[model samples]
Target: MLNTACLRIHISARTTTTSRISKLANSASLNTVAARCSHHAAHYDGPSPTIAIIGSGPAGFYTAQKVMRELKGTKVDMYEQLPVPFGLVRFGVAPDHPEVKNCQDTFGDVAASPEYTFIGNVNLGHDLPLPLLAKHYDAIVFAYGASKDRKLGLEGEYKPHIYSARAFVGWYNGLPEYRNLNPDLTAGDTAVVVGQGNVALDVARTLLSKLEHLKKTDITEYAIQALSQSTIRHVHVVGRRGPMQAAFTIKEVRELLQLDDVNFSPIPDELFPNDLKSLPRPRRRLMELLKKGSPPKEGASKSWSLDFLLSPKSLTWSSSDSDKLEGVLFSKTKLEQADSPESKVTNTDETTLIPTSTLFRSIGYKSEAIPGMQELGADFDDQKGTIRHDGIGRVVSLDTREWDKASLYCSGWVKRGPTGVIASTMTDAFQTAEAIVEDWKKTFDSRRPVRAGWKGVQAEAQALNLSLRPVHWSNWQNIDQVEKAVGVERGKPREKFGNVDDMLKASGASG
Candidate 1:
């Protein structure tokens, strides 16, 4: 998950393109997009570029959107590991934030394009080798976002009550990978979430929000049952840095504050600078909100607080219940400059402990190189957890001679080291699309033969006797309809199938 602080900059820079793209998405007409691409078509007499994008998340779809809008007759084959699409929008987003998922509608419109093909349930590295895609497409775009979460690296951090925010979010949102996470919210009444990101806040809020509020969203049924029985009433969002350096946005903080019957504990006045007037607008507003706190509610059984300048040291188990988490040990830290957001901090010998029954680590996300990326001459920066690129989305090939020939590129978190929000991803993806278009036009004479795209890939798979059941766009629609129909029965937005088999069955792809 990324921060939304850079959203305004992206929106302002691409206002015209976005407005037109919005109109095209609303219309969902091939002719409108074709008309927009006519001028570009006149310049390229060669066959339209056939691109294979890995992942069906916002980055992939937005990249496909811009390329398709600019390159007439271009074909994009999107590969997704699951039977369903919309990677993060479907699995990572908090169920309560439905507004953030409006981008899915645009993704749906992108799938409606005849030039776009959604090949779901196809794992490129496992189901089909990465090298095999090169024979069938002119270019490959890696848009798969970070799939791993960062850890606190503290002693006894992998105990039963400890979980990553990713796993918990996936468990509730119906992601197959973490469907069985089954977090024991009933373990105790207090839980500590280690991080100050929006995800940490999401976990805190979910533990405290009214069941009736979550019931109307697309959260899984099993998750709802577990949450209904949750005994958690207090949450401590712990961070290594002070409030000025916290990663959470003002909107998420404000939402948590406004939850009914949920009280927020006030921050110590000394933690903040004496004169807040010197801080930037966003920081000023957030600090003010933290200072003001939430209104007192009568009979408020749930409360949460921000605990800062505490670096996690170890996890303690309960004395009575040895298997259960008792609390987290933290070493106190002091910032070199209290008022500066980017100030460095040094840990002090003094330590404090916050008693708890559960813990969630939401430090950040990390991207790993897909197995067999080396087969395509692609590189991954292990330290940075990002695909090796030229800082502009073009994957840096091991052989410079094969750079232009390989036509390999990347976008989103995998390219930019998992940081910015959806708006930032869109901007990053659009820039990649422009780069591809420019390269295609520049290297037209040396371009490879016209590739058959998915058609060629399907033939190769059949020849290789690979066991693959691809869920096309129509198949996803069937699954979508069934989920929505089931939602109507439950009086909620939608009840996602808990596993891949159910999704495959709903998509009519089950053998």
Candidate 2:
């Protein structure tokens, strides 16, 4: 069990220096007057359009950028529940995939713009009611990405040794919320991870990388220690569907083949349908790699299996005092073509059990509706767990095509129904922003302006008794300084502040 008291909040709050503000104003003055006028006109013309973005993810940041750029003088405030910004980009993407994180630089640029204010460490439903925000801002965009994991819904899933792949990944990646979730790696030599997506591959690879070959990477110190002490020798990655129906991409599949001690087993031709065999060369190469079963020559231990056509039915635990995960019950499955090109799999209903000490399920993600918005007549899809929006991304009531008076919007995984890579999310964000701009144009002069400027907003926020940790540009610079300094102490590239309060204190924002 982890101690919740150890988790600390890092607050970065300090006013910008006079020199910096003056420099920004001076530089901003050089831009064309037409551009400036057009920007501010979107907010001041109708009823001062106060825009609130409920997330700080890629989609939220991109949407904010588009709105600020096109709407000019709009009052846009972005709220993030985390003390730090960048949702999955910071905590979900693997540390090795740093290039994908370049998106953060772009997000940082948007956050720094004068047109926006980043209110970090504020939970939407908890800190401020959604309806209240809607009333305060002309528009509210719920860009909060799916944080919960999909369950296997099997018997005995509540067993202690079982964990959701989402939590495990977050734990290894040093997410403050899940940093202390240390699984007992010493209990068993072998483990099983269910699902066949990029996330599944990531978990498998991270588990396999426990060998000495990957010790140099920037894995969390605690994760590194736990993995180094792991007793497991093999991991079986099980997928219900055949190779052709697998959700994992070619790149991630190939990366798994390169692991030092692991082996990649190629699927037999009989397992794939005739149509799938006729796929283009790139996909053929992926299938070809899936067919070879040669173990690597080096590493701490050998043996990892990729088992297909297996659906987990239950997680069985040992009756002994150890009370550990004893095995998983599964049913064999077969795939059949659907009406469309995508195929679907059905379990034969026959069952078998495989003994294992640990299990991880990585089905998918689901979105939760923000609280207090239901009264405003917000509609949600029960099957998809997504907010129902029209082509322009406006939240709509179930009864009609008209917009809900609350004018709620969404982007990222929540907007497009939890599918796509970061690049796809960027495209979705751009589309949502375009729609918001279009909506603004129609109601530009009709909205009422609130008496709040930056100063008044600051005063109101301060009066709320919220932590005034300013996380100003200088504070970020200080954080960078401390991170680099600590990284040097450990002989790594950069050591992150695992504890949030320590980071704030080191940045001089917390006394």
Candidate 3:
């Protein structure tokens, strides 16, 4: 259901290789061709401006592509905490939605340019202090993305069988951090997901999908085994608001409805507008589809639903086991006006209990302050889950004393809260690049002193004893092939290596 709008976004945001002795000979030829190409780029032909853009996700890559295309003598060195790149596209996209991952092709094109460089496996503010970047690069773009998840604060939310959507998505998608989640899906047949976002739907779809559907995807082998043994049958995606205010896109909902042998319980018509023509095109289509629902096939084996206008209060425990989840207690909510997007909700006297043994908290994702942010004179807004910015992408200090026009900035989830899709993220990133390019031109002509790109940064890193072992584009290409070869042997699209050491070893990344 990922439609043409997403493809158009790709068109709007439209923006690597080999080999030793034989590799060295190939390397030289490639270098010669690259040098010739760089000289001809028309924009990046002169001494390049050093720009350090942290994080290699869509934001960082798209920003780099736009900057390199718009500015002459501009070189970008992308820094990633992991040896692999394409942050969420690699670890957050649902395994079955291979179409959404198509943006990787555009990112790949950006990385192939001579003006662009890949520096992976180096954690900013940790492996090297953030201030160290100031001395080497002319500009620093923080795009590390959200590293933490928002919690439900419910009393028993941490008990066994309760997981955040990020962890669940990460577990199946092979994120190194959540590889050992090993959620107990056999506890019961019913599961409650406390959110109505696309992620919640993805979790529902994965749980209810046939094992055959998952086996052919790029999902981790360990997750494949875990899901194959799941006892899950029903999924309830609960939300604080009614259908009109739901955050999920029509494509995600349509995909779930179309799943083989999976049943979608219809959404109540009372929650929707009386006249469908009153709603926008997207919402009207979505509401109509939801009201019609997917009637289960003759012998459908599993089912899911959109449980709306319910505010989760707490997780109830089973009588026999205190640590195991049994149900979610929700307070019924009433809409203030209902048909408008600005409608608000308030708790009502009614209450409902959903029986379940497994739970997922998918309210939303929150971004954390990158370490060493304060010493650089920029502060992270704890309340907003973002860095303090001018709302366009510039990191500014509200406190007059700390302000230095710091030339420090951020984009993507770290700058704005994590919300949009790849296409949306691309739009956000391109805007950030515009801001950056505008600033760079003015700064380049000013007395900001002179600097070398990554070369200068590497020299400073060595002097600072940062102990950084970075992976380049070539290394990623090698590790990529290794992962694909492994996948081919197992009959899947690709099998991800879920550990940092394994990827570095596969890349043969040297100090």
lDDT tens string, model 1, 472-499? 9999999999999999899888889889
Q: After best superposition, candidate 2 residue 362: deviation in angstroms?
A: 0.3
Candidate 2's displacement at residue 197, Å, is 0.5
Of models 2 and 3, which has the larger TM-score?
3
Once fitted onto the true fold, the runs of candidate 3 whose alpha carbons sit more than 4 angstroms away are 1-48, 397-406
lDDT of 1: 0.81
The C-alpha lDDT values of all candidates are 0.81, 0.65, 0.78
Cα lDDT tens digits for candidate 2, 288-376: 66765455555436466778789998777767754678888899987776212267778997888888888888888777877876765
* Number of the top-ranking candidate, with TM-score as the measure: 1
Ranking by lDDT: 1, 3, 2
Q: Which pairs of residues collide in candidate 3? A: 19-23, 20-23, 20-24, 43-72
Query: How far off is residue 170 in model 3, in Å?
Result: 0.7
- Which portions of model 2 show Cα errors greater than 4 Å? 1-49, 210-213, 274-277, 292-300, 338-341, 397-406, 450-477, 507-511
TM-scores of all predicted structures: 0.91, 0.83, 0.89
